[model samples]
Target: MVYVEVFGEDRVEKIKICGDFFLYPEDRVEYLERALIGLPFTISEEDLCAKVEEVLGDCVLIGATKSDLARVIKKAMVRA
Candidate 1:
Protein backbone atom coordinates (compact mmCIF):
# COMPACT_ATOMS: atom_id res chain seq x y z
CA MET A 1 0.00 0.00 0.00
CA VAL A 2 0.98 3.62 -0.44
CA TYR A 3 0.06 6.81 1.43
CA VAL A 4 -1.24 10.14 0.18
CA GLU A 5 -2.06 13.43 1.86
CA VAL A 6 -4.86 15.82 0.97
CA PHE A 7 -4.86 19.40 2.21
CA GLY A 8 -6.63 22.65 1.49
CA GLU A 9 -7.86 25.63 3.42
CA ASP A 10 -11.19 24.77 5.08
CA ARG A 11 -10.75 21.20 3.94
CA VAL A 12 -10.05 18.50 6.44
CA GLU A 13 -6.60 17.05 5.97
CA LYS A 14 -6.57 13.38 5.04
CA ILE A 15 -4.30 10.53 4.09
CA LYS A 16 -5.57 8.14 1.46
CA ILE A 17 -4.48 4.98 -0.21
CA CYS A 18 -2.72 4.66 -3.53
CA GLY A 19 -2.97 0.95 -3.51
CA ASP A 20 0.19 -1.12 -3.95
CA PHE A 21 1.14 -2.06 -7.45
CA PHE A 22 3.96 -1.73 -10.02
CA LEU A 23 2.23 -0.35 -13.07
CA TYR A 24 1.36 2.77 -15.01
CA PRO A 25 -1.36 5.25 -13.98
CA GLU A 26 -2.47 2.76 -11.39
CA ASP A 27 0.81 3.27 -9.62
CA ARG A 28 1.06 6.95 -10.40
CA VAL A 29 0.33 9.02 -7.30
CA GLU A 30 -0.58 12.05 -9.38
CA TYR A 31 -3.25 10.06 -11.13
CA LEU A 32 -4.80 9.20 -7.84
CA GLU A 33 -4.90 12.90 -7.03
CA ARG A 34 -6.29 13.69 -10.42
CA ALA A 35 -9.25 11.61 -9.45
CA LEU A 36 -10.03 14.36 -6.98
CA ILE A 37 -9.49 17.19 -9.39
CA GLY A 38 -12.38 19.64 -9.85
CA LEU A 39 -13.25 19.33 -6.20
CA PRO A 40 -14.67 22.62 -4.96
CA PHE A 41 -11.74 24.06 -3.08
CA THR A 42 -12.16 27.39 -4.87
CA ILE A 43 -15.87 27.53 -4.34
CA SER A 44 -17.83 28.49 -1.27
CA GLU A 45 -17.03 26.74 1.97
CA GLU A 46 -20.37 24.99 1.67
CA ASP A 47 -19.40 23.67 -1.74
CA LEU A 48 -16.11 22.45 -0.43
CA CYS A 49 -17.87 20.85 2.49
CA ALA A 50 -20.32 19.20 0.17
CA LYS A 51 -17.52 17.86 -1.96
CA VAL A 52 -15.75 16.54 1.10
CA GLU A 53 -18.95 14.97 2.29
CA GLU A 54 -19.47 13.33 -1.05
CA VAL A 55 -16.00 11.88 -1.12
CA LEU A 56 -16.15 10.55 2.38
CA GLY A 57 -19.56 9.09 1.74
CA ASP A 58 -17.92 6.34 -0.25
CA CYS A 59 -15.42 5.71 2.47
CA VAL A 60 -15.81 4.05 5.81
CA LEU A 61 -13.96 6.34 8.15
CA ILE A 62 -12.86 4.14 11.03
CA GLY A 63 -13.02 6.78 13.66
CA ALA A 64 -15.18 9.72 14.70
CA THR A 65 -12.37 12.24 14.58
CA LYS A 66 -9.08 13.27 12.96
CA SER A 67 -6.99 11.91 15.80
CA ASP A 68 -7.83 8.38 14.69
CA LEU A 69 -7.30 8.92 10.96
CA ALA A 70 -3.62 8.04 11.02
CA ARG A 71 -4.28 4.90 12.97
CA VAL A 72 -6.90 3.92 10.42
CA ILE A 73 -4.45 4.54 7.62
CA LYS A 74 -1.84 2.46 9.35
CA LYS A 75 -4.24 -0.38 9.90
CA ALA A 76 -5.18 -0.31 6.25
CA MET A 77 -1.51 -0.34 5.34
CA VAL A 78 -0.83 -3.41 7.38
CA ARG A 79 -3.88 -5.23 6.06
CA ALA A 80 -2.85 -4.46 2.54
Candidate 2:
Protein backbone atom coordinates (compact mmCIF):
# COMPACT_ATOMS: atom_id res chain seq x y z
CA MET A 1 0.00 0.00 0.00
CA VAL A 2 0.94 3.58 -0.49
CA TYR A 3 0.22 6.52 1.75
CA VAL A 4 0.65 10.14 0.81
CA GLU A 5 0.01 13.55 2.24
CA VAL A 6 -0.77 16.43 -0.08
CA PHE A 7 -0.53 19.97 1.16
CA GLY A 8 -1.44 21.72 -2.12
CA GLU A 9 -3.14 20.91 -5.36
CA ASP A 10 0.01 19.66 -7.01
CA ARG A 11 2.41 18.86 -4.25
CA VAL A 12 2.92 15.73 -2.24
CA GLU A 13 4.16 16.60 1.22
CA LYS A 14 5.21 13.07 2.10
CA ILE A 15 4.67 9.46 1.21
CA LYS A 16 5.17 5.92 2.44
CA ILE A 17 5.20 2.62 0.59
CA CYS A 18 4.71 -0.66 2.40
CA GLY A 19 3.43 -4.12 1.60
CA ASP A 20 4.52 -7.62 0.83
CA PHE A 21 6.03 -6.55 -2.44
CA PHE A 22 9.66 -7.14 -3.17
CA LEU A 23 11.97 -4.69 -4.88
CA TYR A 24 15.51 -5.70 -5.81
CA PRO A 25 18.37 -3.56 -4.60
CA GLU A 26 16.24 -3.54 -1.47
CA ASP A 27 17.64 -0.28 -0.32
CA ARG A 28 16.23 1.35 -3.42
CA VAL A 29 12.80 1.14 -1.86
CA GLU A 30 13.62 4.09 0.32
CA TYR A 31 14.90 5.89 -2.72
CA LEU A 32 11.62 5.25 -4.47
CA GLU A 33 9.69 6.61 -1.50
CA ARG A 34 11.84 9.67 -1.49
CA ALA A 35 11.28 10.05 -5.21
CA LEU A 36 7.55 10.02 -4.62
CA ILE A 37 7.84 12.98 -2.34
CA GLY A 38 6.60 16.17 -4.02
CA LEU A 39 4.86 14.24 -6.75
CA PRO A 40 2.05 16.14 -8.44
CA PHE A 41 -1.35 15.19 -7.20
CA THR A 42 -2.80 15.77 -10.63
CA ILE A 43 -0.49 13.27 -12.28
CA SER A 44 -2.10 10.57 -14.38
CA GLU A 45 -1.69 6.89 -13.52
CA GLU A 46 0.36 6.22 -16.64
CA ASP A 47 2.62 9.15 -15.94
CA LEU A 48 2.92 8.16 -12.31
CA CYS A 49 3.88 4.65 -13.27
CA ALA A 50 6.44 6.05 -15.65
CA LYS A 51 7.88 8.11 -12.86
CA VAL A 52 8.07 5.05 -10.63
CA GLU A 53 9.85 3.18 -13.37
CA GLU A 54 12.26 6.05 -13.75
CA VAL A 55 13.03 6.05 -10.06
CA LEU A 56 13.43 2.30 -10.03
CA GLY A 57 15.65 2.08 -13.04
CA ASP A 58 17.50 -1.22 -13.41
CA CYS A 59 15.71 -2.68 -10.39
CA VAL A 60 13.42 -5.67 -10.47
CA LEU A 61 10.15 -5.54 -8.54
CA ILE A 62 8.17 -8.68 -7.85
CA GLY A 63 4.60 -9.29 -6.68
CA ALA A 64 3.51 -5.97 -8.23
CA THR A 65 3.65 -4.13 -11.47
CA LYS A 66 3.99 -0.49 -12.42
CA SER A 67 0.24 -0.34 -12.87
CA ASP A 68 -0.29 -1.53 -9.31
CA LEU A 69 2.09 1.05 -8.00
CA ALA A 70 0.30 3.70 -9.99
CA ARG A 71 -3.07 2.65 -8.70
CA VAL A 72 -1.97 2.70 -5.07
CA ILE A 73 -0.27 6.05 -5.54
CA LYS A 74 -3.29 7.53 -7.28
CA LYS A 75 -5.53 6.30 -4.51
CA ALA A 76 -3.27 7.81 -1.87
CA MET A 77 -3.27 11.13 -3.71
CA VAL A 78 -7.03 11.18 -4.04
CA ARG A 79 -7.83 10.12 -0.50
CA ALA A 80 -5.12 12.04 1.22
Candidate 3:
Protein backbone atom coordinates (compact mmCIF):
# COMPACT_ATOMS: atom_id res chain seq x y z
CA MET A 1 0.00 0.00 0.00
CA VAL A 2 0.96 3.65 -0.45
CA TYR A 3 0.44 6.17 2.32
CA VAL A 4 0.96 9.76 1.24
CA GLU A 5 0.71 13.22 2.67
CA VAL A 6 0.31 16.00 0.15
CA PHE A 7 1.63 19.53 0.29
CA GLY A 8 0.59 22.59 -1.68
CA GLU A 9 -1.96 21.93 -4.39
CA ASP A 10 -0.55 18.73 -5.79
CA ARG A 11 2.84 17.83 -4.36
CA VAL A 12 3.73 14.82 -2.27
CA GLU A 13 5.13 15.80 1.10
CA LYS A 14 5.65 12.35 2.46
CA ILE A 15 4.95 8.76 1.47
CA LYS A 16 5.25 5.24 2.76
CA ILE A 17 5.11 2.16 0.58
CA CYS A 18 4.70 -1.33 1.90
CA GLY A 19 3.11 -4.63 0.96
CA ASP A 20 3.80 -8.32 0.44
CA PHE A 21 6.20 -7.52 -2.34
CA PHE A 22 9.93 -7.98 -1.90
CA LEU A 23 12.69 -5.72 -3.14
CA TYR A 24 16.20 -7.02 -3.19
CA PRO A 25 18.98 -4.90 -1.80
CA GLU A 26 16.07 -4.25 0.45
CA ASP A 27 17.06 -0.68 1.16
CA ARG A 28 15.88 0.10 -2.34
CA VAL A 29 12.37 0.20 -0.95
CA GLU A 30 13.28 3.09 1.31
CA TYR A 31 15.04 4.74 -1.57
CA LEU A 32 11.97 4.38 -3.72
CA GLU A 33 9.81 5.96 -1.04
CA ARG A 34 12.21 8.85 -0.76
CA ALA A 35 12.31 9.35 -4.48
CA LEU A 36 8.55 9.62 -4.59
CA ILE A 37 8.48 12.49 -2.17
CA GLY A 38 8.23 16.06 -3.49
CA LEU A 39 6.57 14.73 -6.62
CA PRO A 40 3.23 15.82 -7.98
CA PHE A 41 0.36 13.90 -6.43
CA THR A 42 -1.44 14.00 -9.76
CA ILE A 43 1.41 12.36 -11.68
CA SER A 44 0.44 9.97 -14.46
CA GLU A 45 0.82 6.21 -14.03
CA GLU A 46 3.22 5.92 -16.95
CA ASP A 47 5.41 8.72 -15.62
CA LEU A 48 5.27 7.31 -12.13
CA CYS A 49 6.19 3.91 -13.49
CA ALA A 50 9.19 5.40 -15.22
CA LYS A 51 10.26 7.17 -12.04
CA VAL A 52 9.95 3.91 -10.16
CA GLU A 53 11.97 2.11 -12.75
CA GLU A 54 14.63 4.79 -12.56
CA VAL A 55 14.78 4.86 -8.78
CA LEU A 56 14.87 1.08 -8.56
CA GLY A 57 17.85 0.98 -10.93
CA ASP A 58 19.53 -2.44 -10.70
CA CYS A 59 17.54 -3.55 -7.69
CA VAL A 60 15.31 -6.54 -8.17
CA LEU A 61 11.65 -6.56 -7.24
CA ILE A 62 9.65 -9.73 -6.78
CA GLY A 63 5.88 -10.06 -6.54
CA ALA A 64 5.21 -6.71 -8.26
CA THR A 65 5.92 -5.11 -11.58
CA LYS A 66 6.50 -1.42 -12.34
CA SER A 67 3.05 -0.99 -13.87
CA ASP A 68 1.42 -2.67 -10.90
CA LEU A 69 3.16 -0.27 -8.59
CA ALA A 70 2.22 2.70 -10.73
CA ARG A 71 -1.44 1.68 -10.74
CA VAL A 72 -1.41 1.32 -6.98
CA ILE A 73 0.10 4.79 -6.57
CA LYS A 74 -2.43 6.29 -8.97
CA LYS A 75 -5.30 4.67 -7.10
CA ALA A 76 -4.00 5.96 -3.80
CA MET A 77 -3.57 9.45 -5.22
CA VAL A 78 -7.19 9.43 -6.36
CA ARG A 79 -8.28 8.25 -2.94
CA ALA A 80 -6.24 10.98 -1.32
Mark the regions of model 3 whose C-alpha exceeds 4 Å error after superposition. 1-9
Q: Give the winner by lDDT: 2 or 3.
A: 2
TM-score of 1: 0.29
What ranking emerges by lDDT with the best candidate at the front? 2, 3, 1
lDDT of 2: 0.78
Clashes of 1: 0
Instruction: Point out the worst 10-residue segment of candidate 2 by lDDT.
Output: 1-10
TM-score of 2: 0.82
lDDT of 3 by residue, 1-80 (tens): 33333334567766667777777988887787778887787788889999988998888878887778777876666666
Candidates arranged by TM-score, highest first: 3, 2, 1
Model 1: residue 8 alpha-carbon error in angstroms: 12
lDDT of 1: 0.39
Clashes of 3: 0
RMSD of each candidate relative to the true structure: 10.4, 2.3, 2.4
- Candidates in order, TM-scores: namely 0.29, 0.82, 0.83
For candidate 1, write residues 43-77 as lDDT tens digits: 44444345434444444333132223333333432
Tell me the whole-model lDDT of each prediction, alpha carbons only. Answer: 0.39, 0.78, 0.75
